[model samples]
Target: MLGSSDPQNARPASLDAIDLSMLAELERNGRLTNAALAARVGIAESTCTQRLRSLRDRGVIRGFRADIDPAALGLTLQALITVRLGTHGREQIRGFEQRVRSLPSVLTAFHVAGADDYLLHVAVESAAALRELVLEHLTTHPHVRHVETQLVFEVLEGSGMVPREPVHPPHV
Candidate 1:
């Protein structure tokens, strides 16, 4: 969930070696305790707290969330649904976005550029459930022009968002 605009986040902040290391470590594991995080990042506990606060305030780090497996919750099937809009009216777009946010099964929604207006990643219990979701929540919507669904076979997560420039230097 993206947070509301914070003016502080609009401006960039200079992050040092210590900051980068902390971020990389946290990306791998966000549940680390303050003491553990400090130790891993080679910094004092007090300094670690300050750095974490700065990262949050600057919006460099959004809030951490539990990575849940849909299958564990009995949502066994995942699909990517692309939705085409009949009209590009502002109200229609806003209404569609609002409708999507109300759906419990939608994991992510992208307002993309191309033939489709929206791409939704959703998880459901079975193929029937997937079909129901597409027909009831999406294709039937007045503004929707066309709908396409593709089953997902596998998902692989990437090493998230680490800066390439000025790679974390070796500690002296």
Candidate 2:
């Protein structure tokens, strides 16, 4: 479900103003009831419910999740790890992703097109735990060739509305 918006689950041609407004409101507060969302968007409750269902069915809205605090879970240390793989074969990449996904400390992993093959966001208890994670898990892995860990001093997160229009214009 991670890449639900891929070609297999393509969305409608374009999202209308109402759809964009619903997304903006949901981005602010995912727990809003149908009545509340309808009131805010100036739509009937039934219409709001129908639109929400349509969004979900179209894969525009994947799923709702709670914002969990790493600090509350005693995971105070945060790090971004840049990983370069030794091999670019599909099997190797799939195996590496599967292995990393099982690690509890790893919050998110992005397969990127850059100098590094993948970027991992991890949260641990301390520097020692981070060292263990990198040494025992990442570097020791067969496919991983190089790993770089950068400590995160602070994480500034936002829940603003997603842009209705693309920042960059399409090529002529």
Stretches of candidate 2 above 4 Å error?
A: 1-3, 7-13, 159-161, 164-172
lDDT by residue (1-172, candidate 2, tens digit) is: 4326576565354678898889988988899989999999899999999999888876688899999999899999999999999999999999999989989999999988888999999999999999999999899889999999999999997656476444787789
In candidate 2, list every pair of residues with a backbone clash.
none
16-54: candidate 1 lDDT, tens digit per residue: 888888888888898999999999978899999999998
Candidate 2: clashing residue pairs, number: 0
Worst 10 residues of 2 by lDDT: 2-11
What TM-score number comes out for model 2? 0.88
Task: Give candidate 2's whole-model lDDT.
Answer: 0.89
